[model samples]
Target: MFANIPTYWCAKCDDITQFSLKVKEPPQFTFAIRKAMDDASGPVIPYETNYCDFCCKNCGQPVRVKYDEHEFAMSSYRYLPKAVYLYEFAL
Candidate 1:
């Protein structure tokens, strides 16, 4: 199993939030997926992504998480719209 947990800095609460990504595939395979995302000529592979929301352990505010076979990212609290830069993980 491959797993990575990264912290995201939240400007709203002035705190850091941690997110997780766990997959059975190896790092090399995930690298290929990210490569395909970067190269339009690369073949497309079907994958499933899921999102889960839970309250922050510290602030008691809702936190949204999005995860796929390769990575995971954290969104803003509750329904508030926010821009989360997730493509950087491809690098």
Candidate 2:
């Protein structure tokens, strides 16, 4: 359902052999993620991000990403990737 949510390339995790789904899908839920990326504070764990890939980092295998709402109150919403569409608004 969340195929339409936009994804941004996680440059930090990309440097590692395995990709991080948690880090990858931050921009989908909130604009703050984008702001954080551009923020000079450096890389921050996107806890406020709504959805997550339930991956087990120990074995280096691809695991199913799940949608968890409680961890992130502000992003406690989900929709099909297409339905929750956004436009490029210049700020």
Candidate 3:
């Protein structure tokens, strides 16, 4: 159903990964998500943090990237990269 969403490269898995909105997993947030998506004027909450999680469809390894809806216009949304950064949390 979400095949055409977006894709990014994962160095750990050494392959391209698919993207998914973290919010979509929760049933309660569905209405908020829909509202945000339906709003043509702008994101329901400007500056809202939307996590764009990219994971390997094969191994299931995943990485999270932060994004703000106000960062890009709707027309430029498709051009956004699936992976923004590879975070190294602990030393």
For residue 23, give model 3's deviation from the true position in Å: 5.6
lDDT of 2 at 47: 43
Task: List candidate 1 stretches off by more than 4 Å.
Answer: 1-3, 21-47, 70-91
lDDT of 1 by residue, 1-91 (tens): 2124555555556777665533222233355444433352233233444333333345534444444444345532222122232222323
lDDT of 2 by residue, 5-53 (tens): 4343333344222333336443233454345333422333344323332
Q: Which stretches of candidate 2 lie over 4 Å from their true place?
A: 1-22, 25-50, 68-91
Better of 2 and 3 by lDDT: 3
**Candidate that would win on TM-score:** 3
* Steric clash pairs (candidate 1): none
> CA lDDT, every prediction?
0.39, 0.33, 0.45
Please list all clashing residue pairs in model 3, or write none if there are none: none
TM-score (C-alpha) between model 1 and the true structure: 0.35
Q: Give the TM-score of candidate 3.
A: 0.41
Best by lDDT: 3
TM-score of each: 0.35, 0.20, 0.41
